[model samples]
Target chain A: MLNVTEMLEEIKNSPYREIEICAPHTGRVNFAAIQQGSKVEGPHGLWKEKPGTLLCTLDRERNPKPIAAVEKGELCLLHSELEGCFVEAGTRLAVIRHLLTRDEVQAAILKKALHLFTAPERAKYYFVPEIDKKVRTSGSQSVTVKDGMELFIMSRMKREVPLVYTGPAGLIYAVYFTHTSNVDAEQPLIGVCPPDQLAAIQEVIMRVQTEWTEQG
Target chain B: MGKSNKESNVAPAGGLIDVSSHKVLVANRGEIAMRIMRACVKLGVAFTAIFTKEDTASGHVRLAKELGGEKNLYRVSSYHDANELMAVADDAECTAVHPGYGFFAEDFRFARRVSKRDRKLIFIGPSWKIIRELGDKINTKRLARSLNVPTVPGSDRPIYDEMEAERIARTVFDFQVQQGIKRPLVLVKASAGGGGMGIEEVYDIDNFRSVYRRIRNYAMRQFKDEGVLIEQRITDFNHLEVQIVSDRSGKNPVHFGTRNCSIQSTGLQKRLEVAPGFSPDEINYSFDARKVLDDIVHYSLTMARKVGYDNVGTWEWIVTHDGSPFLMEVNTRIQVENGVSARIASVKGEGGVDLLAEQIRIGLGEPLGYNQQDIAFNGVGIEYRLIAEDPDNRFTPWAGLIERFGWQEKPWLTMHTHVPTDVPYEIPTEFDPNLALAIVWGENIEQAKDRGRLFLDSLELKGCKKTGGELKSNVAFLRQKTAGILQF
Candidate 1:
């Protein structure tokens, strides 16, 4: 892996990204109560069943569906001009400048540090039924995989065939693909950390934990 | 290619009432929404349509836009939200709401709200009272039994006492024995539980106690209600339906014809449907097929008349291997396969019978100008539900952006779909990925089957998953089942 210090330094220079929240459907938007630079929190709870902060309500066909902030951030930009006016779906409503959390920063660094097993083709990939069920119940990190293992079942064109793992395998450090959506060709399916690399990965995470300061 | 949505046509006047002033809100999506809009336009009535964010590019949205009316289109959060529909109706100044199957179609509460709300709009169906009366399974079963109409051979009410439950189970078994049935199975299901939960099938009466206790215990734990329903589990039967159409008067109910929907998926969901339920003229059967069809239709009409069913509805039934027809349930709204029956039915020798248009006319308080003697049937019609699914994988739904969908136009073929051909469409995962419905008509069963196969063969559907593989459809499965259409 590349030097973790340089990666951490680069991230330190810019530790935030502005994410735009758009109307999920066509509706008259009401952002009267929202103000710029206000703080927001994403869905949080043991199960994440508790919703995030309400940013605005998009009223259409008599139903007003509230758009919630999905990421913890400061409301840096709000489209106040479009308030009370009918807006089409995907219309820019607000933007949040979300600061990098400790987990996020570590995840960013680990993405480059981990040996990513990418999808060979654009198709729905699943960890062959047993592994899938295990991965669902327990986190993907609990499952260990080996090289040349029959891991995934790549479903395509109504046909299912076993997909053999080729790369040096280990504990799945991170699951990069969801079962519901399609994973693009060459997109990483899972980030694997071999037994030898586990210590190095831990050290990098520890170093970031100590040096990085989280912002409110 | 089919007629574009932008194509303007003059609406023809039908029935005795001039319902031109009414504006209908099509509170649904997909092909059903498209059909409702077409019906409204056909009757010269203004209609409004709604689409969710996922349905931005759907044909229904395009049709509503091109249909040309003030505030005719609106995007809602969900199709299930009744408030949104009512609000849209009020905003659009619509006088009626047509719940085009699914969503709020069969919901009596939604229908009641539509009628009872301050700014009331006609719930373009049977009145809420009638919907509530027929919507309840227990009420329907009891009513059918009271009328001497054949319902399932089982308890109309839930059995609470174990002795009573066992006694009913014994009667069911003895009844099957009296009917000379072999290997009769008794179904023990939690009255409070549905969707196949807490349900057990007992092949032998000796072991029913163990199964009953397990079900009762499971029900008490799961639903907190130990009540159970005992019914004779029917096997080797054909699922049939009678298309009933009546006016607001709730009287003079007449049937279009019988439709056989026995062909289904592994989950027992209907896949292929045929009008004129059976062909006694062509196929030989152990029982009188013609008499069975007539009996079911007559029973359906009798029930429809009893309830004052004031709109288009379907009476679902199952004909056993020995030809005993039992009423399953009553669908209080127009069905997805309504067109199949309409394809073969003619009112007063008029070949084209648009049932939705008739429904709207009747819903607006206009009586059905014709009676049972006027309605006639002439050909075999088949309806194929085209969907993006893997038949080999337990009908697993496939979600992907549909890139291309096309089919050749035939003289006897009518295809209904909300999927636009000119542009790619992302399949909305929130709802069932139903692509289209192809209704093919033929002079006879042999011809109908041939046409169905030809239609499926000529149909071209191409799509790819977001990640990169080709989309899977049930076309091959539908094609294979074409030969077995209406075969008992």
Candidate 2:
């Protein structure tokens, strides 16, 4: 069902997500039961044979606690010196990488529109789908809109609010919201074509991320 | 006045422990980092630089590597991340850390962490205790008043309610009337704010509540501290500051003369010149120009000595049109315009003491070699902050790839910037407005002003195609101000 080239392209574009495990307090590391590149599922997996597991015990003077895996991923100990040495609170102990094999795309309404669409129960809006009647459709199931095209119209109290789609033009594969159902901010209103067609959306997200990074 | 070897081991209340043998870590970026690196090179001390991801190709990083080898360059996610900075310092085996202004320079927690015994690192500035005390405007004003330093009359305490603000405004107005002052104005300032940020002027009593609320919100958003203080705004005033350096030996602090930064637009400093701009024959208050200079130097030293402040710090004051001076705030770190003082002090045959190097020596538990009388001010020095912003667009900050850049070097002109010209370089849009600084010194203010204009005309900034327009500078605005045409 998935193209091999498209799958590889998705893997290349997806950013590597890593979760770091830190020391709870200033203390010595009692033991590290897992090795580098070990698969860790969860905390309970440390005691049993499970797919994802990571565990390390730190010996504080009053309390000895176990630090376990928070997500299912391969464990990579960042500091080997922590085995018998003291570490201050907030020191990184290990990092886990969540490897992905397939591509998945998600579309959501911008959370910034909450002030206009929500909060008032009497608020009402509709998505006036920008379907080109002139263009010949490949089939009845295919519904595609260009980037910056009007995806929907949101109105509150008889006043129309402008809303446009900012992602790459592609086929509308799925719709998550009903015709008259209430939509929450940032809710996945619809599912567009994944992989290559989401490039515009990705660019917008990167720009926003850059802005936030600069602010920090 | 230098410290003996026997007293070097003991750390005073606000003094730096001996760290001469230690490697220094500069936890900053840009021109300030390069300035610190230069100081380290002069002292023959090995130094490391921590740069953000955005600064990997920056000139400061390259300079650090060239000075102390490639191993000395460390990269972090951001300059404000204390954890990463400490980790890098520890990895590099740095014994002392110099936080160039803006990031962790005033962060007391960072200072505490650096000075902790377990960390085994020394902060090359005042102690965390002193920074915390002087950082709060209310506490600083109180301390100044206690030390017989004249401070602006305002709400003696922090005002949380509108009633208190109104009452303080009325009291200040009545006092101004009694003092026979005209056009009394009130200012609401953030207690923990600096750099002329979070300051609002109140012209009328009717809009006091709204202005106060707006200032509080701005302060809360900018500094995360909503605490506000009210003070009488000096309308026709000259912004002057004295740079002072102290050591742990409890000896007298040295004053590096005074700088007049009156050429400011919208509260942002545009140009700063030494020698105060006014001659002794021009205006006479209670004291002549010489007496005023002497009084300022004396007050600055006395305050530093009282607080046991070590290393370089600045005391800012507002000299009213009527010639009365009032303490405004204390900057506990080296300033961007410190080159003006350095240049002025370096004039004549007197050995010019590098303020950054002096900071390092003080951090090494070395007493100031010279006292107040030994220091002399000669010639006039002026500095212009070259910011990458469009003046035509209300000073909106701009960022783009600088395709071409060049500046002519002159004997009287000194430019401090980290523009990467060898390779393609783009200034990050998210940082401060300042791209570089053009500093010039001459035998007199006129020569200095001439050299400043020449220096500005020699520089150029070209943007890439994607940038849409040429990179902008405030040179024209600065020239107008220097020529005495532009006035507030």
lDDT of 1 by residue, B1-488 (tens): 01112211212233244577789999999899998898888778888888887688889888888884536888776787676677667767889999988778877899999888888899998898888888776799989999999888788777789899899999999999998888989989887664335677899999999989877866775567898989999999999999999878776898989999998876567889999899999899889999999899889999998888899999999898989999988888999999999999887787888888888877876667778888889989999999898899878778788999999999999999999988899887556678999999999999999989999999889999866678999999999988887777
Q: Can you list each candidate's DockQ?
A: 0.17, 0.05
Clashing pairs in 1: none
lDDT of 2 by residue, B345-395 (tens): 842246455778878878666666555666776777788887766666655
Off by over 4 Å in 1: A23-29, A33-74, A86-91, A110-198, B1-18, B69-71, B154-231, B466-471
TM-scores of chain A across candidates:
0.88, 0.39
For model 1, what TM-score does chain A reach?
A: 0.88
Best by DockQ: 1
What TM value does model 2 have?
A: 0.71
